[model samples]
Target: MTDRLTIRRPDDWHLHLRDGEMLKAVLPETTRHFARAIIMPNLVPPVVTAADAADYRDRIMWAKPKNSDFKPLMTLYLTEDTEVRDVRAAAEIGLIHALKLYPAGATTNSQSGVRDFKKVTRVLETMAQIGLPLCVHGEVTNPEVDIFDREAAFIERVLDPIRREIPELRVVMEHITTKDGVDYVAGGGDTIAGTITVHHLVINRNHILAGGIRPHYYCLPVAKREEHRIALRAAATSGDPTFFLGTDSAPHTDAAKLQPCGCAGCFTAPNGLSILAQVFEEDGALDRLEGFVSEYGPRFYRLPLNDGTVTLEKGPPVEYPAQIETGDGPVTVFDPGMPLYWRVVD
Candidate 1:
C-alpha cells in the first residue's frame, strides 16, 4: 500500500473566509494545507467592486498566519449594478480572479445577488471578451422549485441558456451536487468546468435529514441522494480536468447552526484535506487526488502552480477538533463520519 504521498500544494477553487474574527480563525486551517484559494465574496454587504475586493483581500492578508504565503484569489459579487470597466480593470491588474453569481436569495448573504440576468448581459459580454471566468453558485431560488432539484433545474432554466448565449464565457459551476451536474460539466466542453466539495462527496441528504436532522451536515446546495453522492465521487476521482476541488468550507457558529432556521454551510476547512485523502484512498484513486485538489484548479484559472508541497502520511486514525473556537463563537467542524488515517505531516 502507498502509505505516504507528497504533491503540489492544493488550491481551493471555492472558499469562504468570513471577515474579522471568523476570517482569522479559519484562514490558517486552509493555508496550512492549501497554497491559495479563490475566496468567496458573500459577505454581509458583499464584495461588489474592484475596490471592495482589494479591501477584502487586504483584510484576509492581515488575518493570515505569520510567514504563510497563502494567496487569496479575490472575486466580486455580481449584481445588476456591477460595472464592466471595474471588472475589466480588476482582471487586467490581476486583482480579482472571477466574479460570482448568486441568484437572489439563493444562500446566506446573497440578498444583493442578481435578480435579473438581463441587467448583467453587458458585464457578461465584457467578461467573455476579457477571458474572466464566472464562478456560479448553480442553484435557482424560485420558491416553487424543490430544494433537491434546484441544481438540475438551474442547468436547464438558467445556466444552459446563458452558456448558449455566450459560449465563449468561461464558467466554473461551484459546489455542484448532483449527477445531472456531473454529466453537464463533463460534456460542456472547454469553456466550462465544475467544483465538487469534500462534504458533498461524503454525505447525502440522508446524512442530514435521516436520524433526526443533523444540522451540522446541513449546507446550501444541500446534499442530494446517495446516487448523486456516488456520481460526485466518481467525477472527482475520475482524474477529469473538467472537475476539481472547491471545499465551500463556510463556517457558522454552533449557535447559529442549532437554531430553528439554521444557516446552510459545513465548516470543513479544518479537516478538508484529511477527509479528501481518506475519500480518494478508499475509492482506489489515490493517484488522482493531487490533480483534483491541486493542479486542475490552477490550470482552469490560468494561474501558476505552487512551488511548495504538502505530504500526507497514512497511519493510525488522525484526530481533528470537532469544533474550532473563534472570537465570535465555537464553530462545528465537518465530520466525515469515518476515521481518517491519512494526515498531512508537513
Candidate 2:
C-alpha cells in the first residue's frame, strides 16, 4: 500500500472566507493547505463592484498570516442591475477572477443575488467576450420545487437556457450534488465544468437526517441520496479534466449553525486536505489525486499551477479539533465520521 504522497499545492476553485473576525480565524485553515482560492462574493452586502472586490482583497491580505504565501482570488457577485462596463473593467484590471451567480434567496447572505436573468444579459455578454468565468450557485430558489430536486431542475430551467443563449460563456456548476448535474457537465462542451465538495463526496442526505438532525452535516444544495454521492465520488476521482475539487469550505459559527433555521454551510477548511486524501484512496483513484485537486482547476480557469508542494503521510489516525475558536465565536469543524490515517506532514 502507498504510505506517502506529495503533489502540487492545490487551489480551491470555490471557497467562502467570511469577512472580519471569521475571516481572520478561518483564513489560515485554508492558506495552510491551499496555495490560492477563488474567494466567494456572497458577503452580507455582496461584492458588487471592482472597488468592493479590491477592498475585500486588501482586507484578506491584511488578515493573512505572516510569511504565508497565500493568494485570495476575488470575485464579484452578479446582480440583476450589474453593469457591463463595470465587469469589463474589473476583468481588464484583474481585480476579479470571476462573477458568482446566486439566484436571489438561494443561500446564506444571498438576498442580493440576481432575480431576473434577462436583466443581466448585457453583463453575461461582456463576461463571455472578456473570457471571464461564471461561478454559479446551481440551485433555483423556487419554493414549490422539492429541495432535493432543485439542482437538477436548475439545469433544465435556468443553466441550460443561459448556456444556449451564451454558448461561449465559461460556467462552473459549483457544489453540484446530483447525478443529473454530473451528466449535464459531462455532456456539455468545454465551456462548462463542475466543482465537487469534500462534504458532498463524504456524506449524503442520510448523514443529515438519519439517526438525528445533524445540522453540521446540513448545507444548501444539501447532500443528495447515496447513489448521488457515489456518482459525485466517481466523477471527482475519474481523472476527468471537467471535474475538480472545490471544497466550498463555507464556515458558520456553532451558534449560527445550531440556532433555529440554522445557516447552510460546512466548515471543512481545517481537515479538507486530509479528508480528500482518504476519499480518493477509498475510491481507488489515489494515483489521480493530483489531477483532481491540483491540475484540473487551474487548467479550467486558465491559470498557472502552484510552485509549492504538500505531502501527505500515512500514519496513525489524526485527531482533528472538534471546533476552532475565532474572535467571532467557536466554529465547528467538519467531522468525516471516520479515522483519517493520511495527514499532511508539515
Candidate 3:
C-alpha cells in the first residue's frame, strides 16, 4: 500500500451513463473508479416518476459488473407535472435518491426538464418534508442572459427563491463552472452545496477554442475564464464538504462531437478520477484530496463512508485512451490521449 496518500473510497455525486450499450460501455469506468455514484436521470424520455426511477434502478443494477458492490444512487428528473405524491412515495421506498432540477432546454436531453419552478413548488416543498436533495443544473434559459452568467443569474433568480421558500431543503448546484456559483454556494454557507467537474477544473472556454473548436471540451454551464477556473480550484480543494466531485460525465459519439455543430458534453469517466487526482496534486492539495473525494460527499448526502479504498499512485505517467469501443461506434474519451501522472491502482 502506498503511504503517499490513503483514504476512504470516493463516491461521485453527479454522473450520466446513458441507456443500453452506452451504459454498459461506460459503467465500468465509473464502477472501477468510484465506489458509488449518484446517476443522472436525463435520459431520452427521462426518469420522471417513482415507477420509472425504480425500473431504471433495476436496469442499472442489471448492468453492474457481476458481483460488484458498485451502488448506483438513482435520481428523478423533475418536470412540471411531476407529482408530489410520486416524489414522496419514491423517497419513502428509497427508490429515488434525489430530485434533479434541470431548467427546460438547459442541457442534453433536458428538454423534458421543469418548465416552471413555481409550478413545481409543491413538489419541492414535499421533497423538503421528505428530506430529499434537489440537484439543480443551475442555469437560466433566457435568450438575453450571457451564456457564462446564467449560473450566477440562476442562483439569484431561481435557486435563491427555492432555497428561501424551503430553507431546510438540501440543494446541490450541479457541475458548477463560475465564480458566481462558488460564491453563491459559499454564501448559502452550509445547506447549499455544489459539484465541480474535472473538465471545468482543467479547461476554460479558451480551451474550447484552443487549437480549434474543441467540442468535446464543451458542456453546459460552459467553462469560464482562468480566474474562475482558479476560483473553482480553491473552492474544490478547500476541504469544504460543500464542494464534491461530480464528473457530469455525459458521453457523445465522435460523430456527434465532431459535427459542424457538435453536442455539448465530455466523456471524462475513462479518465475522470485520474484527472481529479492530477488536479489536486498540482495544486499542492494532495493531503486535502481524500476529504474532498471521499469524506465530504458522503457527509453531505448522509451516506455511510465506504469500507474499501481505491488507490492512485505516483509512478510512470499513464496515457488515457483516445476512444472506447461502443456498440454504435467508438466514443472519443475526454482529455483523450493525454499523459498524466495519476493512474488509479487496479
User: Candidate 2 lDDT, tens digit per residue, 5-69?
Assistant: 99999999999999999999999999999999999999988899999999999999999999999
* Model 1: per-residue Cα lDDT over 55-115, one tens digit each: 9999999999999998999999999999999999999999999999999999999999998
TM-score for each of the candidates? 0.99, 0.99, 0.96
Q: lDDT of each prediction vs. the true structure?
A: 0.95, 0.94, 0.85
Determine the backbone clash count of candidate 2. Answer: 0
Clashes of 1: 0
lDDT of 1: 0.95
Report the lDDT tens digits of candidate 3 across residue range 294-334: 88888888778998987777677788778998786788888
Clashing pairs in 1: none
Report residue 289 deviation for candidate 2 (angstroms). 0.5
For model 3 the TM-score comes to: 0.96
Q: Quote the positional error of residue 310 for candidate 2 in Å.
A: 0.4
Model 2: lDDT to the true structure = 0.94
Work out how many backbone clashes candidate 3 has.
Answer: 0
